[model samples]
Target: MLNQIIELVADELNLDSKTLTKETRLQEDLNVDSLDVVELVMKLEEEFNIEVTDEQAASLKTIEDILNFVEANK
Candidate 1:
């Protein structure tokens, strides 16, 4: 699940998945802007078949945050 999330995020951001770590920040470390995050959430929803609420989306600050959310919701 973590690997899938990393791959999904990397694809969304056009980055190398190997470069991302659990500590990587979605905005600061990955350089993802607000619009990118929205798109990322949409993609994640589509990929995982789960809906992430606005509050949940807002809480996804790091790679670990995303992994935890997917793990809990998936």
Candidate 2:
């Protein structure tokens, strides 16, 4: 699941999956802006068949956060 999330994020961001780590921050590390984050959330929902609320999306700061959320919710 972690690997899948990393791949999805990397593809969406046009980045190398190998460059992403659990500690990678969505904004600071990945340079993800608000629009990108919204798109990412949409992609994640489509991929995982889950609904991520605005509050939950706002709380995701790092790759690990996303992973943990998906693990818990998926």
- TM-score per prediction, in order, is 0.94, 0.97
Q: Model 1 scores what on Cα lDDT?
A: 0.91
Taking every candidate in turn, the Cα RMSD to the unseen true structure, in Å, is: 0.8, 0.5
Residue pairs in candidate 1 whose N, alpha carbon or C atoms collide under 3 angstroms? none
Superposed model 1: Cα runs more than 4 Å off = none
Give the Å shift of residue 10 in candidate 1. 0.3
lDDT of 2 by residue, 16-61 (tens): 9999999999999988999999999999999999999999999999
Scored by lDDT, the top model is 2
User: Which candidate number would show the highest TM-score if scored against the true structure?
Assistant: 2
